[model samples]
Target: MNEALWALGRGTGVVALLLLTVSVVLGIVTRSGRPLLGLPRFSVTLVHRNSSLLASVFLVIHIVSLFFDSYAQLRVVDFFVPFLGAAKPFWLGLGTLALDLMLAIIVTSLLRRWIGRRVFRVVHWFTYALWPVALAHSIGNGSDGTSVWFLALALASVVLVAVAVAWRVSANFIEFGNARKGETR
Candidate 1:
């Protein structure tokens, strides 16, 4: 029935949001400089990377299900090209841009060996770009954007990314401090 399909679509969206939240948390907790308080390095890194990949998988499912569900009115074009959605073209265009960025990051990651570390590292910088793009997509076009769960997830992602960035900055500061101390010695 139509109702059943709508419920399924909503459920899929919810799952995708949850997965994205987990991915962001894992990423923040496993950063080289700010790993989770007591967890072993290898374990945290494993979980973080795998969780991110899982989130990406869920994202693919979420996008695909949009086409199947009659309620969302998602077009294939809206997934690839920006500003083409029948509803709120600008917001949906953000989703399309996010998808493209994700695709580029995924492809480069999978081909890292062939691409070589220097080139791969350059492309990897785009991963940061993907997060903000994805955040905008979820906030701007997500159907459940106002729901408590959605808001929590969005805020968590923002906080996690913020913390990771802060950790990195603090690390640089510490290195600089140590270098100065060494020079004084």
Candidate 2:
């Protein structure tokens, strides 16, 4: 049973990471105000929102499973606090911090209409920080962290995000240049 729990925790953690990667990439696409994979802009936004929610579900399962797994020895306080774990404090703490940030982002997003776009956008920006912190936590603390397969998975996630960000920046820059040229004309 304990082995089952451990496996569950590990599997869910990987799934959550993949889902988060998808969410991040889709988010970048949404912000670009462009369709992705030939889907309409609205469809991309919907998929982004749904993927984020699914990732959160997987993250919750991952945390819960680890908390129950004897190997982890996780305490309830450790769930909310960072750096207090007995083993691999720094790595586990990064995960805790990521969780905290994710909660804030989720809350702000849910209340976006009431809180206004500016405030929501500011909180949502934490996603940028959350992704790397979560990735570091996975690599630093995961049992398979050093395995070739895990490293390859992590590398792919990073590459996808990097490409999306580059595209977004270049697109914006070109738009800005075009606007400047129009002004000069």
Candidate 3:
């Protein structure tokens, strides 16, 4: 039973990270006019939304499995509060923070239409922080974090986020430059 829970925890955590990575990348890439995978422009948003939801589900499963796993020795409060767990509090706290941020993003997104676009966009930007915090948690507490398989997956996620973030930031800078030139002219 303990072994099963531990395995489930690790498996779900990795899967969640993968899904989150894809969602983050798509969120950035879809802002551009170019269609992805020859799909309709609208399809990108659909995929991003679905991927994020799936990630959230997997994250919940990971947390639950770890909480039950005797190996983890996680208390209920530790899951909610940051740094309260016996299983490496600092590392566990990162996961807690990530979860909190993700929940905030999810809530704001759901209320987006009702609240307003500006608020939603601001909250959504929190994802930039969420990905790294979650990654740190995995590396610090993960049993297989340093393994070849995990490293390969982590490398892929890092590359995806890095490329997407760079592209997104540069795109904004270029637009700003163009706008500034227009203003001067």
lDDT of each prediction vs. the true structure?
0.71, 0.91, 0.87
Query: Which candidate comes out best when scored by TM-score?
Result: 2
| lDDT (C-alpha) at residue 151 in model 1 | 87
TM-score of 2: 0.94
lDDT of 2: 0.91
**How far is 81's C-alpha from truth in model 3 (Å)?**
1.7
List, residue by residue over 1-185, the lDDT tens digit for candidate 2: 88999999999998999999999999987887666878998999898999999999999999999999999999998888999999999999999999999999999999999999999999999999999999999999998888999999999999999999987776364435566456552
Sorted on lDDT, highest at the top, how do the candidates line up? Answer: 2, 3, 1
How many clashing pairs per prediction, in order?
0, 0, 0
At residue 103, what lDDT does model 1 achieve?
81
Show where candidate 3 strays beyond 4 Å.
171-185
Name the better of 2 and 3 by TM-score: 2
Residue 33 of model 3, lDDT score: 47
User: Where's the lowest-lDDT run of ten residues in candidate 3?
Assistant: 171-180
Alpha-carbon error at 109 in model 1, in Å? 0.8
Per-residue lDDT over 1-185 for candidate 1, one digit per residue giving the tens place of the 0 to 100 score: 55665666556656665665566556555554444678786777788678778778777777877777777788888888988988888877887887787787778879998988888767766767776776777777776777797788778768877876676556354435565456552
* Model 3 TM: 0.90
- TM-scores of all models? 0.81, 0.94, 0.90
